[model samples]
Target: MNDTQSVNATSSNDTMLVTKQVHEIEQFETFGGDIIKNVRVGWESYGELNDDKSNVILITHYFTGTSHAAGKYHPDDEEPGYWDSIIGPNKAIDTNRFFVISVDSLVNINAYDENVITTGPASINPDTGKPYGLSFPVVTMRDFVNVQKSVLASLGINKLYAVAGPSMGSMQAIEWASAYPDMVPRLISVIGTVKADGWTTATLEQWTTPIRLDKNWRGGAYYDQPPENFPNEGLAAALALVTQSALAPNFFNDVNAQLLAQADGKPDLYDIQQSPVIVQWLMERARGRTTSMDANHLLYLVRANQLFLTGMNDDIEQGLANIKAKTLFIPATQDQLLMPYHLERARDMLKANDKEVELVYLEGDLGHLEGLSGIAIHSETIRAFLAD
Candidate 1:
């Protein structure tokens, strides 16, 4: 075997600090009819699987998140996992009582980060001995859930007590309940929808425009070039747009107001559109993200999110009816991406079909990101739901 095969040979059970492990699935066929000769799924487990393998909770990750859902990779690390507030020993998910697992999505943009292992545009194609680039197959939420099922099977887990996630992770959670209803008994979908509406699809497409228009993009085949030659500008611009959509308008305005107030003596720009402070902040944030993300991987994730549907088909009613899990829809009131109306629509359909479902509105100023920032405020509510 060559270098690629050697990487694939690493065991998923191997543990390194607080980072995730890798499980290689050989010769996989994607939902889009593309064949992936080898797929590396990065996953991390907290707590212990019970003897009967029943007390399991799968914590799917949001966009840009890795499988490191809890604990610190290094003692000096500045932050813990994204959902660390809810996944510890006595927290909402309660690792002491239930085993928790998180997996990095197939084309996760953060695959370049040492903590994650994933097969994406950057990975070497065993057959061609070159980066897959745009040749990496487009995947849907169902495909992500299917891979997670393999992870569970590898661990001897036949059923999950609950599957919970926020944003893109919530999409995977919804897919899991719909695609494998028998496997998941409970699902917590926070800031997510059952289907990607036309508006959502169009918005996602717009996010990719900057990347596609970038000269260095070269149809996703620029990986062999120098770092500076990659589509950093386009990726940064796309991320800036993403940040704008992720926060509530009021929250951004308030932040700008505070910044303006802080510079009391300075001349008021008066024009929010051309505010130097806001533009600088957005650019800096996007630039920081581009430092760790792979452009092609980000594009793949966007496409996957765009094509998400509950049933993996266009029949929304039937898809809602197919979910057997006791579902909870937590929509952030200020979220512009996955709006409250989307969850309301799903709740209405599930109720009409006599499926067990509940809708919970998360009132917050953080918008889509509230799914992470507001967890502490709703910890009790989530804990109660999980217990039930």
Candidate 2:
């Protein structure tokens, strides 16, 4: 087989196929008492916007994603959406009937170009008139949703066709349904549980370690020199952690193989000297993140995920009771990262709440990636659910 074919052969069966773009938005607020007046959000849309705008689908992004969901920014572009395989024309998302939208999460630190408006520790504080850096307030999923909520309000949208996402993004999606049950009609959570597990909390800290150790990090104040020139050791380490096990174990291995092939067979070596994509970006960016956000916020979002007792009739059962929209929970059968039981738990929770919930177990070796890579396996399922 040719090199590209060989690479494709080892890839997870579910791959995205669509065009995407990075966009920016301005003037947003968060629950953490911080207001980002000019927020940069990279976004992508699929299908035409209906005249009533009721067909709009909002996709919440994970911690590291930009708003580049599906289709190319321009006709000649080659890159597809991170989850393109599942959402497009007649694909799982069924662009023919719905207008799909996905936006970059707050403080997104990926390969997005500078034109995308973003605010993190890297952004200047409007109050002090200086970069917030480590001084930026800590944020949470509610804070994130608050910002997106502002975006939706600006567009005159009071309700959403659906709110969907994975991993950290899934946490926000669930919160959107629970926190604003009056505004959402459906929730599609893949390979994500209601609460952040201890396993996740511990693993997430590794992403923050690298930035803390860099001398140039200057406690998040190295704005004068090249931000890229600053110590990226922490970010590199964090990237390695993600590259290794953030997704399903088997799928992680599959992607590992593809990434290795892209590196011409040199394994375990990320391009650090030549790029900022190494594992250290985690630490460099996470320095102010942990503190800037309220410890209560972390406890809230995480506990909300962990406490996602969908089936249990306990305190705040009213929240689950209020989720009137149909729900779909897709879990990776072989997923070691999230474990099949986690999604099962979510299914049970919603069912116990007497909510209309459907469970679709994705079959693939891609583990957690099944949530994304296995989009083809879910096209009919998603279409059917959305149609209802």
Candidate 3:
């Protein structure tokens, strides 16, 4: 498929459900020294920009999320964007009061999904006339913010009212404040931390292991061959592992136990009594992702996530000090992947630096997914923070 082909080919709607646009950057050089001749970033916007452009809020998306932030792609869409509940006219984000915008991160995994447009490993390299594959430059949160800076500039927005996001999105928010503290007045980071700790780095390594081990992976160059050459099974397994980590262990276990109880006295297979059944369910969910996701794209996202650190340098203290935006850190109480303690450390650093910062813990059972799924519970708090 060509770069212009939408990843979401299954969407039957002749018209787009959301207003998707692209910003193309010619001869963009990445932080890692690789050069992409042409870069396309998919983006969507909600509400309108005020004449002064002061009522704009940049909403960065988390890993696996798309630029579609609040609207249904079509009337038949099963659901809207990830944060639909929190962003809309008079909603928590209050689109009536602010212009909300979201952009696909560089090499966003969603690009692998049909109907989504992004320049990633799968995009045709102008230099090679083929897929970039493993040749795609490694990008950082700073690179994400830089591309977004271009997007904002293209829209004639010189300053932002606030920058907010969850998970990987939050990382970009932090980067924005550090990279351009004067441009952002406020920041809301949910279920994220300033740096990728040893635990997070190790977990990410495990997530990519399966894909790397897959014989079909071909060192991220599988695109040169046929569809059968793709690492579907490995990608599915990796996604399953991600799903397992995306939730609270206790919540998952409790639900599993309840399901097992309800299956009591049933036939051996029908009972679903074994732990393997839960594993099977997780893998099944992963299998569904394999249809819309590419292993190489996922690997790129994982690598970007692994390298996340707040400051320009490796100095966390200096990075925290440079941030002038009033910041709110919302960590999920039950999030095992991005545990509250990680945010606690960040809070301490921000406080020690005397930056305007607030720490809030999201009390929910969904764990890391709570950032998106449990937004309702924290909507009022977010609204108030933005208002203040």
lDDT of 2: 0.61
Model 1 has a clash total of: 0
TM-score of 1: 0.92
Off by over 4 Å in 2: 1-29, 247-319
Q: Write candidate 1's Cα lDDT for 1-388 as tens digits.
A: 0112111111122222354566778877888888888888788777777889888999898887877777776666787788888877778888777888887889888866877788888999999999999887888787788788887777767899999999999999998988888998999999998888999999888889999999999989998899889999999999999888888988888887887678645445785655477677788889998877898988888989988888887887777778999988889988988899888998888888888888888888889989887877778888988887
Tens digit of per-residue lDDT, candidate 2, span 250-320:
55456555655566435234644544222233334444333223121222233323433332234445656
- List CA RMSD, all candidates: 4.4, 9.4, 4.4
lDDT of 3 by residue, 1-388 (tens): 0122222211134322465777888877777777777788887777778889899899988888877777776677787888888888778888778888888888887656665767889899887799988888888888888888888887778999999999999999998998899999999999998989899999988989999999999888888787766898899889988888889988788877776677644345655664455666677788888877778888889888888888758888888888999989999999988888877898888888878888888887899999889877888888999996
lDDT score at residue 93, model 3, on the 0-100 scale: 88
Worst-scoring 10-residue span by lDDT in model 1: 1-10
Candidate lDDT values, in order: 0.83, 0.61, 0.82
For model 3, which pairs clash?
Answer: 7-113, 7-114, 7-115, 8-114, 8-115, 17-73
Q: What is the lDDT of residue 232 in candidate 1?
A: 96
TM-scores, all candidates, are 0.92, 0.76, 0.92
